[model samples]
Target chain A: GAWLGTAAAPHERPGARRGAEMKKLYGTDAAKIQAMEAALQLSFDRNCDRKQPKYWPVIPLRL
Target chain B: TSISASSKPGADPASLQTEQRARSMMRERFLRCLISMANKKIQFHMYEKVKVDATFGASDIDVLNFQVSDLQTPIGVQTEALIRCQDVISYSFDM
Candidate 1:
């Protein structure tokens, strides 16, 4: 797998894989996001859709 | 009292025909592919590239296809999907 990542800014879409329990999944500050993304070196947003239908997340920064 | 674990059997011919029919049905769905090699070759030579991308929604995906770019062949003219979309999710391929 060359790349596997979620959309950036999980809170923006809110319809992420975590469901309404998004807060419980990522803490209030996004530590899980950092860890998963760091481990994979890929973007991780709670978001599902990627690119097209309007390219987004800009560059998907790690920070 | 236990049944034997090792069992060997042959496929029934009627079942085999059913499997063949299934394959035939799928092939028929893509009838164009059933045409002569020359025909496929024509399409193959005509299109330089083919792209596939998915568009997911709140609960499911809406896979889409559209030509992003092409110089030698007709683009955005052909598209297919295994599942129908319930919402709008468009995508395009670029040359």
Candidate 2:
């Protein structure tokens, strides 16, 4: 079977579940990511289609 | 504004003061909760059930807080943390 798009195995720290999710979020629109982080989204998993690993959002949060 | 108890002939000033304070705190906490929920919903889009449960703790700064677990009908979450409102939610009240 094709492992493409599938995240790492369950035992894997960043397994397929996470890998698949990250793929969508690796690179995305900045405005949306800033919005998500502003709302206390401390964690950004692979499924995050907005930003990168740093879910805290280094950028200043705009009100 | 003239409150019922205030106008009452035998209203206890002490108790009324306490009630007023409590009401004020409750209003603050409730508004904070609403904003938090709205921000969470807007941000994650998946956090439609985000909630904020507040309690009057020993200190004004540290209020008891809770949230419904993720995806729970009433906003539920599993965690015991003393969350401060300013710590989260970049809220802007236009109205």
Model 2 TM = 0.22
Interface Cα RMSD in Å, per prediction: 19.2, 20.6
For model 2, the docking class works out as: incorrect
Q: How many pairs of residues in model 2 come into backbone collision?
A: 11
- Highest lDDT, which number? 2
Q: Across residues A1-63, which tens digit of lDDT does each residue of candidate 2 receive?
A: 223212222223322323333323222322333343334322212113232212111232232
DockQ of 1: 0.02
Error of 1 at B19 (Å): 0.4
lDDT of each: 0.26, 0.30
Q: How accurate is chain B of model 2, given as a TM-score from 0 to 1? A: 0.32
Q: List where candidate 2 sits over 4 angstroms from the true fold.
A: A1-63, B1-10, B42-95
How would you encode candidate 2's per-residue C-alpha lDDT over B4-94 as one tens digit per residue?
5432211554553454355445544554554444324212211223333322111121221212222222344322222333334432222
Cα shift from native, residue B90, model 1 (Å): 12
Q: Go through the candidates in order and give the clash count of each.
A: 5, 11
